[model samples]
Target: MFGRSKPLELNVLVLRDADVIATALRTALAAAAPEERPGLERAAALVEQAAAVPDAALRARWVHERLTAAGHEGPVDSVRAVKTLRESVPGLGLLSAVQLTKDAAAHRP
Candidate 1:
């Protein structure tokens, strides 16, 4: 007898690795419209190297510019920051969840 295939499920855990997240984000960013892609690509590449905590924060702060350059910063431009983060992460913890990255960095696990 033929066996049934299992349904696919995507986990929604918040990732914390810049490299790993950037790889996944690059794919999502490619889904944007043609005109609004270049900036996203730039952000993706830059984001890929945001291994440093400060770089990650800087990227998040200027995420709008990066997306705008890509040609997709629209009415809800703020979303760009959220989207950028969704794609690339620096690490997760009470510190990051509450913007205490510097403190967390100072105190390594």
Candidate 2:
């Protein structure tokens, strides 16, 4: 019989189309000068295929993981924008985040 295990409690955030992000990261890594792309390709695939987690904390964690794979693990102050929006308008920040992404995509060069 297998031993019992403690359930991991995670605040899962539903990130829509995270695989796309992962895919982009992979492409960027492949094109980059360096060749030690450890988790970049997998990260890209995750971003491109992972389902929306339905939790802010989880979403943030996913972002953090991907960002880490992309060689970023410092100064997440800018990434922690949800607290500001939540403080001002509760859960409205989620919509704000989505809208911002939409706007950015629409205006992408």
Candidate 3:
């Protein structure tokens, strides 16, 4: 008897390392549309900037600033905030995104 095929499931990629993030960005760039290219390029540049920084705290602070500027801060739902952060900064890992969300929530007005 023939076996049934399993349904396709979406997988989440947690990008933490700078090299891995840069590779993902490059792959995205290859397939992105004209309008989307600019944003992806910007994310790639951010990854480079973060990689160049030797201090971990400074990099985290820079990432937080970027996340806040993109309106991924405040009392927003944690799940949504993490998702938005990943979307905005493709190089951000799940743990970092969650921490950043909590940090934003703590400083909410």
Candidate 4:
């Protein structure tokens, strides 16, 4: 006879709005230890500030800043930049990552 096994259950919380994320962070902050409170508070504030910006704009800015900081600009190491973009920005399509990488390369000083 085969042994009985428990069914697997999954719970998922999707945070589509920045306000929702900030509220969750705030809730976590109330119970966070002294050492962890600062990080949670800062995350909540950042989410609130970013709430006004569209997600696409935020992703673009982050990609630009990361590529620039990594010195992957001006067509140099562009392949790596694409990889970095895809890795840093989850769910970013490959074509979009390539385009952003190319655009960054073109705008390099």
Candidate 5:
């Protein structure tokens, strides 16, 4: 007898979830020093923008721009930053953890 396959589930960020991540980013940003706050603020703004866009590609573009603006460097540095954020703030989900580096890579020059 053939076994039934399990339904596939996409672990992506819904528009509403972007706000949750932004709130977490804001909380993290608030605890950062004034010198480090600007970068965090830029990222939070991008996340807020992503929340309003329904398209994944557009949201990814926002994440890419935020990563580059925040001086995330190449893919390795970008991935490291996302990992650090996820570890430091458990509320950040997997989609957010990979969004910067993965999408940025596609949009990188």
Candidate 6:
């Protein structure tokens, strides 16, 4: 009689929380001004596209660009938004990005 075979298992990796991000984006869209809603929606699309990439750096860059572009009015609002987003996402790059924005705003005339 042959010995019993052992069962095999596979491991899976989670990249990002798309649902959480989507919910956050929806909240942002709802809170946005009528004129700003379009831009915010566009930014959300950029984030969704970035999520497809497996590399963290690339994803961070995409997020950074969208946030930077959306930050046209004031640094304080931008900083707050970035901080809130960082909390939801959780990453060093995001922290640095928010810090850099704050630093730039501080030095501006």
Q: lDDT scores for all predictions?
A: 0.48, 0.48, 0.69, 0.66, 0.64, 0.58
Q: Write the per-residue lDDT of candidate 1 for residues 1-109, one digit (tens) a residue.
A: 4899555432223345788778777777868888878878887877756655454444334433434455553432234434443344444232233233222223332
Summarize candidate 4's per-residue lDDT along 1-109 as a digit string, tens digits: 5999655432212235887788789889999999998888889878878787654455455567876676555553367778876776677666777766664454543
Displacement of the residue 105 alpha carbon in candidate 1, Å: 15
Measured by TM-score, how close is model 4 to the native structure?
0.37
TM-score of 1: 0.29
lDDT score at residue 7, model 2, on the 0-100 scale: 56
Each candidate structure's TM-score, on Cα atoms with residue i matched to residue i, is 0.29, 0.26, 0.37, 0.37, 0.36, 0.35
| Candidate 2 accuracy as lDDT | 0.48
Off by over 4 Å in 1: 1-16, 52-109
lDDT of 3 by residue, 1-109 (tens): 4898655432333345998999999999999999999999999999999778554444445546666778865444368767887788777677767766665555533
lDDT of 2 by residue, 1-109 (tens): 5999655433223636565666668678967665546566656556544454434445445444443455544443344433432344344445554443333333322
Candidates 1 and 6: which is better by lDDT? Answer: 6
Alpha carbon lDDT at 8, candidate 4: 44
The residue ranges of model 5 lying beyond 4 angstroms of the native Cα positions read 1-16, 55-109
**Candidate ordering by lDDT (highest first):** 3, 4, 5, 6, 1, 2
The better candidate by TM-score, 2 or 3, is: 3
Instruction: List per-candidate RMSD values in Å.
Output: 16.9, 16.0, 14.1, 12.9, 11.9, 16.1
Any idea how many clashes model 6 has?
A: 0
